[model samples]
Target: MPKVSRIIPILENLLFFWLGLALVLSLAGDSLNIPSLLQVLGRAHPLILHFPIVLLLMAVAMLWIKDEKIKEIGTWVLLLGANLTGLTVLAGLLLANEDYDGAMLFWHQWLGVASLGLSVLIYFYRDKSSSFLKISTGALAVAIVLTGHFGADLTHGENFLLTPIQSNEEEFVALDDAEVFQHMVKPILEAKCISCHKEGKVKGELRMDDLAGLQKGGKNGPFVVPGDLKESLLIQRIHLPEDSKEHMPPKNKAQLTDEELEILQLWVESGSSFEQKVTELESEEPLFQLASNKFSNQKSYTFDAASDSDISELNNFFRKVNPVFPGSPALEVAYYGTSAFDPTSLKDLKSIKEQVVKMNLNRMPLESVDLSFLRDFQNLEELQMNFTGVTPNQLSNLEGLENLRNLAISGNSLGAEAVSVLEKLTQVKKIFLWNSGLDESSKENLRKALTTAHIDFGFDGKGIIYALNPPKITFDKELFQDSMELVLSHPIRTAEIRYTLDGTEPDSISSPVYTAPIWLKKTAQIRAKAFAADWTGSLTVSDLLFKSGIQPESYRLAFEPNTKYKAKGAASLFDGIKGKTGHGSGNWLGFKDTSMELEIFIAENTSPNEISISLLLNEIAYIFPPENVEIWTGNQQGWQKLPNTDNAQSTKIEEVRFGMLTFPLPETDFDKVKIRLRPISKLPAWHPGAGAKGWVFVDEILLN
Candidate 1:
């Protein structure tokens, strides 16, 4: 034991010496490649760190043990602990050489090394050196705690453990009024970057805790060169590929999304101003509206005061009256839940006449006579009376509402003369009129009457409204051998079709204009959406087409398909059209509560290496993968199961995913091939709708 004790001190001195050398090497290690062995050992720093923590704490506990034998045992344990602490510190040093925030690494690293050195010293002089032991023990305890704290912060986030309790609710800011830098951009930086780039934790000497520090830059210099994202190092680092070693937030850390990156880029392009408001950007600009929606805060009004009792009294089952926001004095009165709304409900709201500033009487069964009560709501800024039986004369009642900024009466039986009355309200900014009985010429005249107000003809309506309808993707045939041509058409001839070939939904600006027939050569998903300059964009319609490049002359199904989902004879299986995800799309062949057996005959005797079958899985709809699939070959024994391939079956139950499952076949020449698909008898307990019948949805089965 004495010899072991003497050898431990020698080992401790060697570790202390190596630590000093490592500290010097780490200064330049960020750019240089270390030995692969050291790098491999460094990867274990996270798992190895806890050992020293437990040992050091146990050593501290040993100090309080009154027995002499226990004290001797404690000394031996301390010696073993000193060796472990040194090894942990060495591993940590190797880890520190890799990419990590330097400021965050500094204190934890040095303190850990110091604690190990103290442990070694205390182990040697526990009996003979009382004063040294007493001083070093307290210092070691503090050093270990602080080192662990910073280490925890490095692994998680700064104050991660404390965040749950320390977090306090912050005040909300409206998107239009919010400062671009303070509310939108800075918060993103603080959450994602500031932990590594803040004051004490400034990795690369870049402090992002304050605007001034960001302006001053770090070791590489200015983070932003105002209006030049290309020149800005901050933007450059953020835009780096997430897999890249130089990427901001580093590997495995939470990353900034495309939207957040766009917002950052927009702020930089707008001169990186701290005080710029979202309202300053025009509503027509894409980023302006995008940022406006992003920063929108839904909170109670903070203005003086609406009577809650009065507002409550004005509300009923069909009609509701409340503050525009939580604490605002301005009230919003709306009617809902009734298919046939009674216009007389407007009379009850007269009690909160001074408070009401927005009234939504959408789908109300109102006429010219019912609108007479609206003149009392002089403070009303927004009025929605869409789908009402209102006429031209009824609009005159709203002329008294000078504060009205938005007036929506789109689905009424009003003429252009009704919109002309809006000219009297000088403050009106927008007027909706798609379904009103106004002609094109009358609409032009109405636009001239209200020159300041934007005439909205329900141009952006999404749901089942009368003005705009979704586009249909028409094709000669969904399945084709070599290629398929797609045509996009809408009910309204004037609508333009915009499409994306990458399976993502088409947007107005980003999607390509579909002028000609889109030809597909390989398996591709085409998504097309319709839009008009003066009408709302349509919902996307998607179609997946397959190009197997091979043809089968004949095929047979062992069992008949359900009457509701039968394909056109046996040729449907060989057809190169891929089915969509849903069951109702009619592209799928669903076999409910039954297994599938199929045999295909080709004109030529070709020995194909593999065959792939397209299958759909939507557990909610009880569509599941086949329990087992078997392939048979025509040999001397007539038919036999093919040799099992290397592909392993997945035991995991996942969400809806349409996939092409490939099965390897034996190299044998046969004109005919048979496939047997076995479906699950019942849904698993993990499924939401458990104990239900399992279905197998198969589309195109292609031999390659």
Candidate 2:
């Protein structure tokens, strides 16, 4: 008998032929009623199609068998695959012939017929070892595949094969804008916000990433008062133009999402003062039962559990509260425990198994815990089995933990096998393992395995020791003064990282710091820590922010030229094209006077820092880029650049950050000059092609 695979290649060849014919039919505008005909045969095209697919797939599997000598037996199996596949192709061709179509189905018909022909040709060569025969067979095989794929696409959408990826992406645990802020939003803000807004050295004077943070809007004044979104200075800054000086996120930082904004709004309007969140959810029953107290309705919850405690605690929790699920009790429960882990107990908990929304077995030994009990906990939202004896094998019973959102397996003997059980529970986002025996590779692999949810592991009992960020020294902007504001912020939840500016660790006696945003400034050091008992210390970024002193008046007292130079005027040091780059020293174009209408180029000599100049075009109208313009002197030395997307129009000024340009006049110091230049968009020279067009042309003379 021919080996299974020997038959498979032949069958697969026939299958591809059919597949190709299908594609050509669809493409050629065939109104193929083949599917309808197959349906009439009681084996629709969808059904008839499966046989060829299975046979071809079986043929490939037969080929993959490694035992060559014994594989001969499998070779015959391939022949069977081929025969079945041929049957499939015949049926498919018969069905295709039923479709009558216009030009649209013309190619579809040909593609199918051609595929069938190619499959027949390939089948004839399956037994031949001749290279030419093999090559010819291979070419036919490729065409067959291309035909099949296009056929499927015609039946399905362009992403039919990749629908899983899109579905997975779309199915992440969705948190609304409000809930999003509670989790994702608050974490980012508390991590990066708060500084430069708390106290005296306040830059914008806005301190809250919290309710208070919102209430105390920064320099622009109270961002959000009670119930006032429009009046909120905080929201105002968020809405500022990205390049506007009032932009709130400061420089190089991610912005808050609208969802986070909504959370802030809701909390503010209601005077949100809740600090601890998880604990609040713990007692949500009170709010759930407060209004539904129709005492006459005596409700009972029935669950299946091996243990009574699982039901006992649940009953106690729901003792005073009966959740109304539609018309019945809203709560459902289930439990699974064995005599080893208390099998009788697991069984008893099963009585009210449907109402078991939350089950706390923290630190309880589940060595023999009925692993399959998870199937009963369909309503289980929060399962605390931390410190339980869970291993890799028994964890598979948790495949039914689809509703399990929070699972703490900290300090368990759980290993790779246990984490594998997690793939089925895509909804489970957070599985905490503090001091768990999880290795780095397993954790990373689990991360890849669970794309929808985040997994976290922390050292046991070793909570994060806080590290306080240094205060912003806001004196004369960029210059540190004795009165600069020092700032420190910490995680709003639980933390305290030791920090210091005197280059020392902050001790409790060293002025215990609160987690709130603090403001102060000096050469003095600062730091923080978790101070809680048995907490893991956090790393600190020492000297995070050095207080800035007041910068002195930096404008050089020199004569600058004006525009509209008499093109014939002799040129001076300040009256010609200038270009510069680098950090060595002050390279300037000295102008004895701006009287001469000569053009001078005063450029930045490649300094990484801002290189700006006040172009005095008192003589005539001067042209330069608009976006990069800056004010002369004071704290207005900030540089701005236009987005590269905007091309420099004929009227647009050419601003280059890679270098600079200046044409100071020595012939005439004109009256009223527009300081029409700021530093260019300073991106790295090696950065991807962007912000590159930095040439500024000034004609060296213009008319006002």
Candidate 3:
């Protein structure tokens, strides 16, 4: 839809024309009574008001001659007013059935109806026959203008139609956030809340779990106020649209019931203060070790409000299931350290009625335990035997581990032939066989059988394994020509180096390989590629690493013509660039291959005003659309963007900055610019074509 200004006036014009015609017929003295007539126009009030306000305004703009469609719309509105005002009068008859007392309202209604009826008459005929319709429509409009004045009087005391909105800041409150946090609100936060807030687990940053913590507020904010609930931060949250960031009791947590909130409000009104602690008091009921698992306080939480009994039950239960690393990966397998495992503790642990989902026997005495006893743990989900004397066959007793999802047997003496038997238990999702006595082929076979399960080491392979790339140099600081040298030493001396200077070719003979560091200062790249023979040097194994050199201390900047620097009288600049080429995504080209010095300057005269440049240096040339380039001076408050234009170059670039996007650009009155480089990239999942597509070249900034 067009803006409101563009649509309102047309509706206004059409409405007045119809009203004038209705009045002419009434003055000419027809049997159509004024009340009935006004009622008729009043009926059209709702349906016809939006038309002139919107359509006539558009007609005014049409005089500028920009849009071709408005003339047709004007013609349509003229026809619409004629039909609607006729209908408005018909509806007024129905409304007339209701008795109205106010004369202003009575006259406004009847006059509108009478005027609309005359509008129809003028639309059909007039004193002059040839121009009858035109004269009649004009008369109808004049009648509406007179009626509008009266309606305005009834609605806004005569001048409501011509006033602007008032904006006075003093009408609002002016309280500091910290002040609202302290004495005014802390009292409502009682001891029943602290379990999750006391120490390490301040979830939601709201430690209402305690009074002191509540005053400090978490990621949310201070939770109370004095004398006023509307102005309080806590009140704001409680009233938030449940799922909103400002929503209190922020989803998934218990909310303060009506009664609890009333107490809190009462406390706040009574000059919000902290509740005092009385340590001497004792309760009849003693807090015991939790006898359950679900609400274990081991997993911390900071509830806005929860009962004391709820907190106690959850805390006791967690301290038990927490057997070392409860939620995280178990670090202390009994066999690894005696402190982590006590035989007596294990003896009592085995007698527990609860199911054991995980069992570790790395340094533990699982071999001595009756294998038959292990069968009782039907709920076992994971079992680890890292570095143990037990063979793969020893776990045959755990064959029916219906819930066993993972098995770790790394650093063991189990071979592939024995590991295969466990593969039949399809429930296993992962098997860690790192550093075990298993054949690589056997591991591959087991992996294939258990397509969904990942087997790492067992039956994997024997011997040293390494990857062969196009080629890579084992050196430090290839870019900027740092002192680090490339050492082309391999597992064996049968390989030679052959590389290219230009980044295009990965072929051999590009450069001579040696045992020393190569140094140079120019625009050139070297690929320390490796070539080896299988006893006979007819064909070479492929491997390569490219290194490019740059002189950061000495670089030049230049600008191209036809480049747009600013987005027309805006605070932001513009750089319309397509994709520049270099390594993107999984393909990583060193910084040496993609480096450039960029310089931006203000254009002397242009259709658009001022512009500036801000860019970051990144190791890659990856650019994707919806792409943003951010630039900032270290001392500035924030960075800005280079808005897109018709020119593709003005829309995208290879730099990254933060804080606010869609920001305006810097001024164009600077001489020497110094900025650090930062960059980012969109991965394949974020973009199609694997995000490996874009151009990344650099030069001086340009303006159109």
Candidate 4:
């Protein structure tokens, strides 16, 4: 009893102190400067708030109990609840300073303070008349409920409580009348992004609530560049690895599904027009097909759902069977792992054949499999067999699929006999025959035979000439002791890959064609491009290959890298695996506000002629090139410094790329080599985080 008396006064004093602070902060509003530490604590408001709510409700419930012991326990619970209420209100006040304002925030703030005041009143009046105590407790409960209601609105957006009851079915718009942006693009943004980027909470200064705000993009650049997916900030952020800091929708927020991302990319690729209608695009275009699938009246399935055990038993690393949507009886089955595919795997799906509405057999070796297994899937609406070994004789088996509306058989060699077999599948509304060995004459014959169906031959190259994508150049190792074979390839099989090793641009007429992997004996820069007979040549791509003189026995770092980016410690620099652009990739060793010092030890009789350091530059992420590099050679006695090289400062932001800094070493034999790389002490004024320390990312080091 004595200890309780002493603690009561202390808690009362703390409650009053917090109450006064909350009042001051509420009045100061946006004028006060909040420290970063307090801002972090404010973020914890969501976590700490539930305690007071439950405690106060429990105290109110206990007060109604007739037992005397229960009333005594209620008094102590009331005291704890009142104090926590004050603390919660204070934390909420601090959190409101994060540019959060609206009617919802305003009401939630005042109601929370009102709840705190009423809780204190009920706590101090425990000894008074029962009627007065009842009134106060009732008011406190009502205040807490209202406060929580508005708080949920502020955090999750308005009408969050009623979202389950709200109609989710999109209103049907006729395909000819639907505007591409209005019916397709805007709804995706509203559902996925507008909660944080709307008027009440504008994260990154970007707003998605209106078309005008989208046109006037935020701090970085334009949200959408017409007909340019690569330059659009919206596309770029979405394409980033989900772990990257710049990834859209944040890690905790709802993410864009694959279909949603494809829609956005298709919209951007087709000029990103606000007023373009679905009828304006060609019927064969992917965007038009997506619009048709979204806006057209969907078919209703009558099949019963497959048993859970049957569905579970069919799933493995090589095959997956899932419902077309949540709670839907219709199933979509897909097969993967070409090497793991078995003909019996298709037979195993017979248990769920009635419910199977879609099946993807792309890239599977289906030539030997008895495709008669598909005739049983009468409910199948879509089938994808692209790049498979499906023959015309096998395709004839699909005539029994009465409900198959979409059929994709691209990348297969189909002769004229395939046209008669496809014409029998009268229910198939869309047919994809790209690279299917069907010439223009055959395609014309099929079109005339099946006038009701839409046939897509895929990019006729009539008036459009696409620039081929850059060829991919890969090698076994960047630093080779003796020799390495460098390989070049392109996605278009007919495209010719041309290469050059003299650091000059590769042209189709003069450069050597890459028929076989070129063997590299010495250090050289390999530049390559892809060219086809009809399409324009692709942009040149280049990579450096270093001829290593001697392999290092071991290496060690003078200081450890940042804890988050410390990949494999000192071993990462010699692992021969290059880190990708993002820092989240575990192959990089990142240093911030510090220098990178490495000591490499070689064999006793080895002499190195040159050294190469591979570094990553992502200016948008504040990873800059090293300010200066110094080389030192050491024997058993001491170290000797060589001529140092200072790098040029970055003048503008650039895409993520890797650069090699090679230094020529004098003729000398040394057992140990020390290299120092100094990161930029302060970021330039034009950068987003100006005056802040920059980062240095090193993935590998080579000795030649």
* RMSD in Å for all candidates: 15.2, 25.5, 25.1, 11.6
Q: Which candidate, 1 or 3, would have the higher TM-score against the true structure? A: 1
Where does the lowest 10-residue lDDT sum fall in candidate 1? 647-656
Which lDDT values do the candidates have, in the order given? 0.71, 0.43, 0.42, 0.83
Off by over 4 Å in 3: 1-334, 337-382, 391-393, 397-405, 410-421, 432-449, 456-511, 531-696, 700-704
Worst 10 residues of 2 by lDDT: 614-623
lDDT of 2: 0.43
Writing each residue's lDDT as its tens digit, candidate 3 over 511-612 gives 455445544332233545555643222222222221221112221223221121112211112212211121111111111112222334322232212222
Q: What is the C-alpha lDDT profile of model 4 across 435-533, one tens digit per residue?
A: 888877788988988887878888776788889989999898767878998999998999999999856799999999999989997667789999998
Give the Cα error of residue 412 in candidate 4, in Å: 22
The superposed Cα distance between candidate 1 and the true structure at residue 605, in angstroms, equals 22
**TM-score for each of the candidates:** 0.45, 0.28, 0.32, 0.58
* Candidate number with greatest TM-score: 4
Q: Sorted on TM-score, highest at the top, how do the candidates line up?
A: 4, 1, 3, 2
lDDT-wise, the better of 1 and 4 is 4
Sorted on lDDT, best first, the list reads 4, 1, 2, 3
Off by over 4 Å in 1: 5-9, 25-33, 124-135, 158-330, 334-357, 360-470, 473-541, 544-612, 615-704
